[model samples]
Target: MSNSFSDMLKKNFNIDLNKQQKAAVSHKDGPAITLAVPGAGKTTVLICRTANLILNHNISPDNILSITFSKASARDMKERFNKVFGDFIKYDVKFSTIHSFAYFVINEYARLKGINFKLIEGNNTSLNKVRILKTIFHDVNGGYVNDDKLEELLNTIGYVKNKMIDISDYSSYTVPQIKNFNIIFNKYEEYKQRNNLIDFDDMLTLTLRILKSNPYLLDKYRNKYRYIQVDEGQDTSKIQNEIVKLLCANNNNLFVVADDDQSIYGFRGASPEDLLKFEQNYPTAKTFYMEENFRSTKNIVSVCNSFIKSNKYRYDKNLFTRNENKRPVTIVKTRDEHKQYEYIIKKLKQSDDLSDSAILYRNNLSFISIAEKLDKSNISFYVRDSKLHFFKHWVVNDIVNFLKLALNNNDVQAFENIYYKMKGYLSKAALRYVKEQDNSISVFDRLTTYPDFRSFQIKNISILKRDFKKLVKKRPFEAIRFIENSLEYGKHLKEYCKKTSFSYEGTKTILSHLKTIASECNSIIGFLTRLDELQALIKNSTAKKNNTVTLSTIHSSKGLEFKNVFMIDLIDGEFPSLGSIEAYEFGQVEDLEEERRLFYVGMTRAKESLDLLAINEKNEEKVFISRFINELEYIMKENDEIPSEFSAWMKIGMIINHKRFGIGRIMDIDGDIITIKFKSIGIKQLSLNLCIEKDLLKAANS
Candidate 1:
C-alpha cells in the first residue's frame, strides 16, 4: 500500500479492491496462490497486481509477464490494462498465453541455435497433424481410422505429452485399436525430428529441453521476467506448471490465481493436484482465498457452494454473495423429455427478454430436440457450440443407409455404405461382384451368387433378405428399432465403441435421440426430410447473431453468466454420466468430481433465477434425477421429511403400504405424483409432498 497507487486505481479504473484482493495485489514477493471463487473478479485482482508491481514497487514493465488460459483472455487482459493505465504508463507490459510464451521461447532458442523448425500443428501449418496421425494409425493397426478413433488418439497423445509421461509408460495408457501405441508415438516423434517438424505439444517439451539443457538461456529467461502472474492456474497442465516453475526458479515471485473446485479439465491432462500441492513445490508460498462471488444471487451462491462440497478432492472454501435472493433455486420435474421441452418453451414465451436467459446441458445431444422444438415454435436462439455432428454421425448414416436399402433392395449405393457395418460379412471382392450383377436383383440376394462366399455367408445373406422384406413395411421409428435390434446394428456399434475408445453411452444416447426424431415421421422419406431440416435449422441458428436465448453445453457456458439459467436433462446418466458413476462406485472418484464441478459451474452461472430440470421418464424408461441435485437438496436441508433414499424407493409398479390406505401397488409415477391401486381404496394419486409430510407411504417389504 502506497496511497498514490491506491488513488490511481480508484481514480483511473474506478475500482475498489476488496481486502483479499488488496492482499493478493500487494504481495510482490515470494510464491503465492489465490483461491478465487467463481465471479470473484480474479482478473481484476491480477491486472491490479500487475499494475501494483509497476507503479508502487517500480518494477520494470518489461520484466513482468502475465499468463492467461486463452488468446482471447490474453487480449482482453491487455485491453483492460491499457484502459486502466495506458495514459499513465509509457511502457507496455507483456501478457501472453502460456503456449504463446512457449512458442516465443522456442523461437528465440532456435534463432540462437540456428535451428529451423516447421510447425506441423495449428490452422496455419502446412502439415496436417490429424492426417499424419491417421497414417501412423493405419500403419500400426492396419485398419481404417474413423473420426472417433482419430480424436481419441490425438487426445491420448496430447495427454501423454502434457502430463510429461515417460516413453516407457505410454503402453499403460489405453489407446483403442492400437495396442503398441508407443510405436506410433515414437515413429511420429522420429518423423518430426527427421523433418525438423514440431507440433503444439512439442512447444512445451522442446522449450523445457532447451531451458534445462541450456542453463544460459534458462537464466536469461528467469532474469528477464522477474514477476509472473498466471490466471486459471487450475487448468494448467503439469508440463506447463513445470515450465512456470523453471521460469520463476530464481525469483520465486510466482503468483497463481486458481480455484481447485472449478478444475474440470482433467481429460486435457490438467492437474489440479499440482495446484492442491502448491505448498510442497514452494514451501514458502502463501495461500489466499477470494470467496466472495459478485455475479450470483445469495441463494445461487449458497446452493452451489454446498453442492461443490460433496467433492472431497477440492480445497475447502465457501462462496458467499451480498446480493439478495430473488428466488429460491427451483427443481422442476417433468413427466418426460417432451414435457421438459414444453416447460422450457412456456417459460421462454413468458419472458420479456430472451437474451438474459440460458438453457445449459451436459451433453451436446441434449440440445437437438429442444433446438428443434424452439425452431418449430418460432423461438429464436443462439447455440454456443452449434455442432450438428449427431446428424452426420456414422451411426445415423448407417441407420439411414439401412432404411434406404429396406425401401429399395436394389440400392447398390446403400449396400456399399453399410455392408461392412452389418452382420452380412460381405468383402470388397463380393461388393465388386454384386455391382456387376443385374440391376433389378436385390444386393442381399445377389450376394449369395459370389463364388468365394462361404455357406454360412449365404445363409446370413438369405436371413438379411428376409429381414429387409419385413423391415420395408415398418414405419421409420420401427425401422430404426429394427436396424438397432433385429438387424444387430446396435451390436456393431458396441463393438465399434470398444475398438475406437468412443463413448458407448454417448453413442446410444445419439441413437436414442435419433429414434425420438424418427418417432415423428410415418415414412422414411419424411424422416430423412426432417433430419435435413433439423441440420439446417441448427446450422442457421448460429448465424442469426441475435440477442436471443442461449443454448450451451455447460463446458461452453463457463466464464459466462445469465440472469436466468435452466440446466436441463439433470438426470443420472446425462449429467453425472454413467462412466463417472461407475468409476465412483469402484473408488476412482476423479471423474465423478469433475462431473460435480461441471454441475456446480452450470448452477453458478445464474444471477437471479436457477432451475434444475429433470424427467422421471425418457423414451418410456424410468430415469432418476442427477445425484448432484439430490446432494445439493440434502446439503440445503430443504426436504428433510423426504428420506435420503427416496429416489431409490420411488419406482413404478412397486408394491407399497400406506398407513391410512393399507397395502397398495404402485401403478405409475410422474414427477412426484405417485398413482397407486390400493386394495381398500381403489386407485389414488398422492403427491410425494403429502406422503412425506404425513408419513403415509412405505415399501411393503420394508
Candidate 2:
C-alpha cells in the first residue's frame, strides 16, 4: 500500500495520521486485531486501512463491512473515508452498528431458512417486561402484594439483568423450587411474545439462538461477510462474541479494534470476559499492542501505570508521553466528609486554567461540597449534577420546602399537604382538627407533630415514614408536592395580610415562579437553596453557603479528568468499598478488580502529575499510603529511584487497650467513637466518648 492510497488520502482529505496510522496502513497482509486506547487515532487507522485495501490490496470495498459502536462513530468513519479516498471510493463499502448488521444478516437469511420473525425495536423489550410485571403484581411499585417481597424481586431482577445473566437458564428452573422466579421470567417472555418487541440484549441473544438452531442461516451470513471489523471491542457483549465467532470461522479475515482498559460498560451488560477470552477461543489469533500515548505527560502516565499495574489480569501495556512533567497530583486527607468537600471546592476555584478539571465521585450527589463553596464565593459552575435542584426558592427546589415541613418539624404544612393529596383517607377527627389549627407550618411539619395529630390517630408511623422517604427520592417532584400540600393546609397566613393574604393562589404563584427559576438554574442544588430567600423558607433553611473544599469517591469522578488528582480512601472499606464484600470475609473478585481499574482510570485522567492517598488509620482523616504503595515502590526502586515509606499511611486509633482497660476494638469507627470491645471488661459502650484518634503512622519496615 503506497502513494496510490497515500495520494488518494491527500487528494480527498487531510488527516494527520501519526505513527499508529502509518503502521496500520503499512501492514500488508493486515492485522487480525488492533487495540486502541482513548483519544488515539483509531478512526484514522480505520480509514487509512480501508483506503489501503481499496488502492493497494485491490479488494472491493463492498466485500468489507465495518461495524462501530455508535451512529456518531459510523458518521466519523464515513467522513474519514470520504476525506482520504475522495469520490474514487464508492459508498458500497458499508458501515453499520453491530446490531444493525445483525438485523440485516438475520433478515437476509431468515427467508432462506423459511422462518419469518419480525424485527423488533429495543425499547419494546423493557416496556413489555414492565407491562408484564404490572399485570402479574397488579401494582408495579408493590401496593397490592407483600411490599417487601415485591421490592426484593424487583431488585433481584434488576441485579440479574445488569449482570447479564441469561434468564433462559433461570427461566427453566424447576417451578417448585423457584416458583416466583419462574412466574416473573415466564411473564416477561410472554409479554415479549405478545408485544413482538426486542431489547438491545435480545438483538444479539436472539440472533445467536437462531444461528445456533439454524446453521445454514449462519453460513449464509458467514459467506456473505468476507471480512468484518469490530470497534470498541471493550463494550462488546457475550452475545456479540458469539456472532463474531460464527462469522469468523476461518479466523484469517477478522479485525478487532478495542481497549480492554476502557471497558467501562459492565453496568450495561458488557463483559471484560469477552475480550479476555478472545485469544483462547481464536487459538491462532495474532495480537499487537499500542503503547505510545499522545495524551498526558510522562508523570501522568507513570501515576496511571502505577495504579493500573495493580489489576493483575489486565493486558500488559504502557503509556508514555514526551511532554515536560508539570505539577504533581495533589493528596488531601481531611478531618471528615465536610473537610473533604471543602478541599474539592477550593481546587475548583484554583483550577481555572485547566479546561479538563472536573469533580468526580461515586455518588452523583458528591458535588455537594463544590455546590456549597459556589454559593459563598459567588463562583459560577455548570452544576453538572443530574440528581436534584438544590436551591430553595427555585421551582425544582422543592426539597427545601419538603425539608422545611418534615425535617424542621413543621406540622401544619405537612398535614395540609397530606390532606390535600388524600382528603378522603382522613377520619372525622382529622377534618375537625384541621379546622382548629393555625395553618402556618409546612405540611411535613404539621403531619408529623400536630397537636391534633393525636386526634386523627393512625396505626404504624411506618406508612408516613415511607411516604416521606418516597418524597426524598424525587427531589424535584418533592418540591411540587410541598407547594400543593402547603397551599391545601395553610389558610390563615395566606389570608392574614388583607392587602396580600397568603391564599392558596398566592402560594401556587410563588411556587410556580420558583419552578421557573429552577428550570433556568445553573445548578439544581444551588437552585434548591434559592427558596431560602423567601420569608416562609428563610426560617427553615439551614445549609449555609461557605468556601468549602470538595471531597468525593473516585467512582463519582468518571468522565471527569483533572490537572491535579487526589485519590484517598484507598482502604478496605472505601476504594474497596464495604459494599464490595460478598460474605463477611470474602470479596467479590470482580468488584475488587473493577475498583482497581477505576483507580487506573482516575490516574490516567491526570495531565502532568498524580497523587495516591489512603486513610492512615482504619478510621481517621490522616492520609497514608496503601499496601500497594510497596509494589509501586519496588518498580521505581528497581530503576534506582528511592522508595517512599509506608509509615505515611498508618494513623493512630482512638480506642486502645491498657493493661487495666484491656484490649478494646473501636466500636464506631470515625473521628469519635463511644462503644468498644474490651477483652478484660466484657463490654463497654460510650456516647460522645473520650475515645480519640492520634496521628501516628506505621513505619515502612514495621
Candidate 3:
C-alpha cells in the first residue's frame, strides 16, 4: 500500500515522501502523534494521510475529520487536498478550524434545543465586546483605559476560558488590573447570559458542555468522525484538547501533528505539555518525529537545532536539512540601533529582490525606527503587523497637550486634556468651573478662582502655572524632561498605575521612546510633525504588499519563509524581554523557554541566509547581546569538530578563561587585536583569531 501510495504521489505531484513522513501517512489506526519540525511538510503528510485513510483503508470521507487551529490553515489544507486529489476521490473530507467545528456542534444542538444566543463578538453582533469591557473597566476603576490594557484584559479572559480555569480561581493567574478581576469576569459572563449573547470563547466552553452533557450528541460525533486528525497540536489549549479527546474516544484513531519546539503561544493558554504527555492520554499511541527540514539551508538547520537544545521541556529531536549551505549564519553587531538600521538598509540595497528579504523583531516597536530608515532610504517594505497604538497612547496625548498649554496658556482645550493627568488634583467639577470662565485667561489661573478649592489645591495650581511658563522657553526634549521630573507628571503616572494596576514600566518605556523621538526634533512643532510623518509612513508601507521587503514581529512571521532573514534588536532586555528574564530568575523557566522558541522560529524562517543583529549600546547605555545568541555560540563551539580560526562570540565585558592567564574579562576588540584584563596576569593583548584557533581562550561559565 505504501509503495503504491508513493508511486501515485510521484506520478501526480512529482513529490517523494521521506521515511518519517511516509510512516506518519501510513499510520491509519489507533492513536498517534507526529512531532513535525518546521518546514517538515506536516501539512502535506496530513493531506496524504487523509487520502491514505480513504483510498487504502476504505474509510468513508464523511467519517474523517481534520481540524487545525486557524481558519487560514484549514482553508489551505482543504484547497491543497482538493488540488492533490483532483476528482480522484468521490467525496470531500471535512476540514475545519476547532472554532468552526465547535460552532457546527453548537448550531446543531441549539436548533434541536430551541436555544437562541446572539454572538457579541464578530461583525454580526450589535454589542461590542470591547465597548462593554471598557465600560465595565471605567465604571469600576473610574479612569480611561488604553488599548493595551483593554487588549490584556480581553486576552486574560480568553486565557481563562481556554484553560478552563474556574472564575473562583481567577486570582491564581497573573491577570491584568482589576483587583476584583473575578467581579469583572463574572460581570462579563453575566452580561452575556442576561442579554442572550455569546462570545468566541463561549463557543468552545459551550460546545464542551453540550458534548459532556448529551451522550447521544457526543456519540453521534464520535461515530461520525471515525478518524480525527489535528494540526498544530502544540498550540491546542486544554479545552480544545478535551473536545478532540471526547470525539476520538470511541474509535481511538487520533493523529496529532505538532512540534513542541515551536510552541510559543503559552500566553494564549496553548500547552505543549499536553503534546508531550500524549502517551499518558493514549497508552497505545505511537509518536513519529519528522525532523527533516525542507526549507532552510543545512547551516541554518544545524545552528537552530543546536540552539533549541537549551530548552529543557521539549522532545529530543534534531532538525536537519538537505538544502545547500549557501552561507554561514552571520551575527552582526553595531554601535547602536541607528547603526543597525544602516546595516539593514545597506544589505537590502545589495539584495537582488526586496521581496525575498525580511526584517524580523521580537516586539512591534523595534520596527518603528527601521521603518523610518527604510522609507528615508526609498526602500519599499511591508509591515506584517503595524500597530499605531504608541502614537495613539494617552501618554503621547498628555505630553502634546502639555506642550500646547506651554506654548499658549490660554489654550483651554489643552489645559482640559492634561489638568487631570498632572500633579494638580483637578476634579471634574473644577474642570467644569474652568470651562465656564473666559477663554482669554490661563485655565490654571481660572482653576485657582474656584470657590470650593482647598488651600493646597490653589497653591499647586499656582505652581503648575509657573511650570508651564518655564516650559515655554525649553526645547522639545527638555520640555519632556521638565514635565516628567520637575512638574511631577511621571509621579502622577506612577500613582495612576498603582491605582489602576496598569503597567508602569510599559508606560515609562513609551515615554522613553517618545523622548528619543523628541531628541531628534528642535521644537514641539517638529516633534509633532515627525510623529505624523512616521505614522503616515507606516500606514503607507502596508499598501506596498508586493515587490517589497517584509517587516514583521516574530510571532507574525510564523509559518513564513524568506531568502534572507534579519532578526534585529537582539539585545538582552529587548529580545528575551526583561519580564521573561525576571520570570526565569524567579524559577519560572517556561517564559524563557518560550522566548527561545520564538528566536528559534525566527532563525528557521531563513531559506538561505540568516543574520542576527544586536546593538552594543542603546541610548548611550551599554547593553549585552541576547543570552540566546550567547547560547547559540556555545552550541556552535561545542559542536565544532575543528576549532574555527575566528571567534564571533567575543564582545566587550564578556568574561573569558585563558589557558595561561586564568580568568579574564574582554577589555576591547580592535580588528584582530583583543585586550583582556586577566585576574592573575594583569592586562594582556592577544590575537583574537589565534586564541580561537589554538583553543587558548574559552567563555567563562556564568
Top lDDT hit? 3
1-702: candidate 2 lDDT, tens digit per residue:
475556555665766555655665566442355766544557777777776776677877776778887776787788767765666676566778988876776676667666565544323544444344556765333444332244345555543554546676654421122235656655765766675555445566667777778877767766776777888787676667777777767534777887777776554556577777768877666675556666676655665566566666667777656667545333433344444444444555666543445444443333433344444555544433233322322222233544444443345544443442332245556545654655664333334554544543433233554555554444553444443453332233244324431234323434433444344344435455554443223222233233322333454443344565555434444454444433324644665566556656666656554554434442122434444444544554443332221112312334455334656654443222235566777666642212211222222233
Candidate 3 worst ten-residue window by lDDT: 639-648
- lDDT scores for all predictions? 0.83, 0.52, 0.84
Q: For residue 589, what is the lDDT in candidate 2?
A: 60
Per-prediction TM-score to the true structure, in the order listed = 0.86, 0.61, 0.86
* Residue pairs in candidate 1 whose N, alpha carbon or C atoms collide under 3 angstroms: none
lDDT score, residue 39, model 2?
A: 41
**Rank order by lDDT, top first?**
3, 1, 2
What is the per-residue lDDT of model 3 for residues 1-702, given as tens digits with 9 covering 90 to 100? Answer: 379889999888887998888889999889999999999999899999999988988999999989998887898899989998858886867789999999899999989999887777854555778888888888776876788777778889999999999888877775454555677888888888887777889999999999999998999998889999999998899999999998998879999999999898877889788998999999999999899999988778988988898899999998898887656676666777777787788778988889999999998877777776787789998988687888888888889889988988888898888877777778999989989999888888898899999898899888988988899888888999899888789999999988866667667657766766776778888888988988887887776466799999998888889999999989987789888898899999988998999999999999987888877877556888899877766665565411122344566898988988899999976644689999998999987545633558888873
Question: Cα lDDT of model 2 overall?
Answer: 0.52
